[model samples]
Target: MKYLVREKMFSIGDDFWIEDEHGNKAFYVDGKVLRLRETLVVQDPHGRELAVIHKKVISVRDAMTVERDGEVLVTVRKKLFTPFHDSYRAELASGDELEIRGDIIAKEYDIEYGDERLARISRKWFRLRDTYAIHVDRDDADPAMLIAIAVCVDRLVEHEHEKHEHEREQHER
Candidate 1:
């Protein structure tokens, strides 16, 4: 199954509409601003909350957690010192671990379970900015969960990029 994730620009905070391959709205992402830590809630089309994502504090590495019904479902942490591609580790609630690595800057990446690829995320498929595509193996993955992960990864990467840009500006001054 394929879905298009598009972020709405010029809003008070991050907001996204996840659309199916047919362009029908499938899910809604409501980003909570004015919070201590970054937080986002993903809701189904009918407005039922599906997952909650929040930044993990007190970690040496950048990390975030996905929760459902107040229970931790997955914890995603970035691997420091990746010389080549950006890499991340995701610990699932089922005790199964997954690896995420690829061209994060270009938004082309894959979520893999050992030797099997469960999802592919890419921005090359769309020409518009702040938009990307997520193709998942429906038989092997839950679309909602995968979508939540992708959203969290995107936000984290974007936040890091903004921070670096600010630091660069400060250095120039």
Candidate 2:
């Protein structure tokens, strides 16, 4: 189904995950507003007018839930990022900056019984077991910092695992 917000005519595509108010998960060819773009009017560091935006999109492989405020929430999957559960909070900070292109929009299409149907008609949908995006600012806060921290934590976890594995091997030998 297609829904028009403002003047933009959006068509929901094929792969979408939906979670209702009751906490039940549903998959849609293109889920309804599983993702959205919120535009921010701001001035750059140099005081130039710029359109800062945060496109909150859901992950592909994880289940997601939708709140009454129309916000989509997804869990941190282990495969997407190591030590995925290092922190329980998933909300992006105010100064976080997201990397995305002007044309980077989510899309999906489905084929059923050799007949293609629009699973999502221009609305966003969440993906079961997928990551989500939250755009912030590029000021004092940096998204890369969080990513780096997460990476470091993952490495540490891996290092511990490897050490244990090595000890096990030695014992066996």
Candidate 3:
């Protein structure tokens, strides 16, 4: 399945929708504002919450948590960065691990469990500059969970980008 996500859809308080390849609304992202930490709730069209993605305010490394039915589903955090690529680690509640590696700043990457690819996240397939598509490659993949993971990855990347920009400005001052 392919889901299209708007790149600018991460404004802390601004809401947006993830559309299917056929252009039908697939999921709604409700951005929560004025909170101590960033929070986004992914819901179905009928308004039932599917998953919640929120930042961990007290983590040593920048981290985000994904929850379903109010239970912690997984935690995603930056593992490291290289000149050519960036990496993130996802620890699932069931003791499984997933690794995300790629040119994340450019919105291109893959979510993998061991050697198997679960989903491919990319923007090159889209014509619109602000639109990117999340392609779930595995038939057993959970579309909503994968979408929430993509949302978390984007927010984490942006958070790091803004922090670095701020540091650069501080040195320039």
Candidate 4:
């Protein structure tokens, strides 16, 4: 299944609906405000929360957790030593690791479990430039979980980008 995601989700309290390829609302991103840490809830059209994505402090590196019903489903952490392409690892609660790799800032990447590809996120399918697609290639895969993971990585990348920009501006000051 392929879902279309608009790139207008850059800030806290920004809410948006992600639609399927058929143009029907599939999931909603509810950004909760007035929280000490960033939190986002991925909900179904009927408003049932499926997963929660939020920032995790106290870690050596920045990390985010994807939770379901107060349980940690996956914790997304950046690989500290990537000198080439950007990457993140989704540590599943079931003790499996999903590798996220490729040009992340461009919204082009692949989520794979060792040898199998679970989903691919890219802007190559749409000409809108601001919209990207999440194509889940496996029937056994949980789409919401994958989507939440993507969001997790996105927030991390955006935070990193913001930090870099701040440092650059400070250097020039």
TM-score of each: 0.89, 0.23, 0.96, 0.97
Q: Please estimate how well model 2 matches the true structure, expressed as its whole-model Cα lDDT.
A: 0.27
Q: Is candidate 2 or candidate 4 better by TM-score?
A: 4
* Reference-based lDDT, residue 67, model 1: 96
State the TM-score for model 4.
0.97
Native-vs-model 4 lDDT?
Answer: 0.93
lDDT of 4 by residue, 117-149 (tens): 999999999889889999999999999999999
Leading candidate by TM-score: 4
lDDT of model 2 at position 169: 100
Candidate 1 stretches with Cα past 4 Å from truth are: 8-12
Which is the leading candidate under lDDT? 4
The digit string of per-residue lDDT tens for model 3 on 47-107 reads 9999999899998899999999889999998886556568998899999999998878888
Q: Is candidate 2 or candidate 3 better by lDDT?
A: 3
Candidate 3: global Cα-lDDT? Answer: 0.91
Q: How many Å off is the CA of 20 in candidate 4? A: 0.5
> Over 4 Å off in model 2, which ranges?
1-140
- How many Å off is the CA of 71 in candidate 4? 0.5
Q: Per-model C-alpha lDDT, please?
A: 0.83, 0.27, 0.91, 0.93
Q: What lDDT does candidate 3 reach at residue 92?
A: 98
**Which scores higher on TM-score, 1 or 2?**
1
How far is 154's C-alpha from truth in model 1 (Å)? 0.7
